[model samples]
Target: MTYTFDIIGVTPIPKFVQFQHQFAKKPDRSKTYLGSYECSLDGLISATKMIPHKPNWDWDQVLEEIINFWVQSEESIQHWKKQLYTVREESLLVARVANSEALRQEFETLWQE
Candidate 1:
């Protein structure tokens, strides 16, 4: 199973930063599990405007560092549970904003101003 979260509007650009954590079996015959992760950014831009894609941070490097640390660190069920909660919270926040008609109108108004 994979867990996903999005951090929206945390940067200058109007974009959704998606984070995914993937799980799979290790290549060795140890019958152990391993994790791989990835992140993507989708911009919420106006159709009339064209802007080059850029991010201030090195997202790939940050993701690599985080995954490396997670894989190397000793973890228990509690740690994973905490991570699940974090994912849930971020996911909920994204959902809330995406589903809010009022928020959408507000952004539209701001953009038109």
Candidate 2:
């Protein structure tokens, strides 16, 4: 079964970031699992924004880089249990893009002040 990523609880402040892996075909809430990676708001913004600029990189490679970033930044890599967390490359890419765009808007407002 295919799976996708869902980003939740994102805020303007640097706080705990939570994401989930869920069956793509099934929208049921019960079919999903949650996972978290400790990262600063800046790190999250940078990683998600930077990946899209590399035109040569494929989605799989991009996903690998993101996974590596999470692992390296987190002290306990065990949190990334395979069964609970799986990255659907495209879904993550889309989520990151959307996230970055929202961040961009937020930042623009701050900058304009």
Candidate 3:
């Protein structure tokens, strides 16, 4: 999977079309937000079925990809200061919602650190 990074506060505008309008007002800079969004090249994917995401998808690999991308591309490390991990319980929530006992345990173990 390809990953892209956006440095908050460095650019007045964000690259993603979805974020461009939302960040227009410049919400609280101190708060950290992490999320995933879906867009289709062809219209069929979204029309056909809901995208199934694993409980730890964002917590594990996705977060690392985002951080790595930013680290490699950004000139200054300061932009990463506000990037925060989405709480560990969120992973447990996703696991419970997906009804995956193993995923729940994985999150529990990771959360202990």
Candidate 4:
């Protein structure tokens, strides 16, 4: 289930900015949420990048492609959404020292610019 997206990037992407504003400093949030959101956006961008610069694909195909993307993902967002469900299981009430350490390391390495 683990993947490359699990690791923070060396440079923060544009989506990460919005992710921070909405999900970063909130009662219901975690690095996994940000990571999942980033991956989802990345998938969209990556998909679009595959198309030729011109109108290689019609509008309907593009829309179909977008819908197919999530449908193809058997796991869907449940992987992360479920994590958000059980606040206790997610360690929402307590400080996750280990996770914080990893997240800090991620920010330091990724946001250095």
Instruction: Assess every candidate by TM-score.
Output: 0.23, 0.24, 0.24, 0.24
RMSD for each of the candidates: 17.9, 14.0, 18.4, 14.2
Q: How close is candidate 1 to the true structure, as a TM-score?
A: 0.23
Query: What's model 4's overall lDDT?
Result: 0.36
Better of 2 and 3 by lDDT: 2
How do the residues 1-113 of candidate 3 rate in per-residue lDDT, one tens digit apiece? 22233433221113332343453244322112233221111221121122222222333343444446544754433323322223322211000011234435657888899
Cα-based lDDT for every prediction: 0.27, 0.34, 0.30, 0.36
lDDT tens digits by residue: candidate 4, 40-113: 53444343433222222244444454455446654644453444344342121111111344456667877787
Identify the leading candidate in terms of lDDT. Answer: 4
> Clashes in each model (backbone N, CA, C under 3 Å)?
0, 0, 0, 0
Query: Per-residue error at 36 for model 2, in Å?
Result: 8.1
Higher-lDDT candidate of 1 and 4: 4
In terms of lDDT, model 2 sits at 0.34
RMSD of 4: 14.2
Which tens-of-lDDT digit does each residue in 1-113 have in candidate 1?
A: 11222232221111223221111121211111111121211221121022123223333543443344434544532344354355623322121011133335657887898
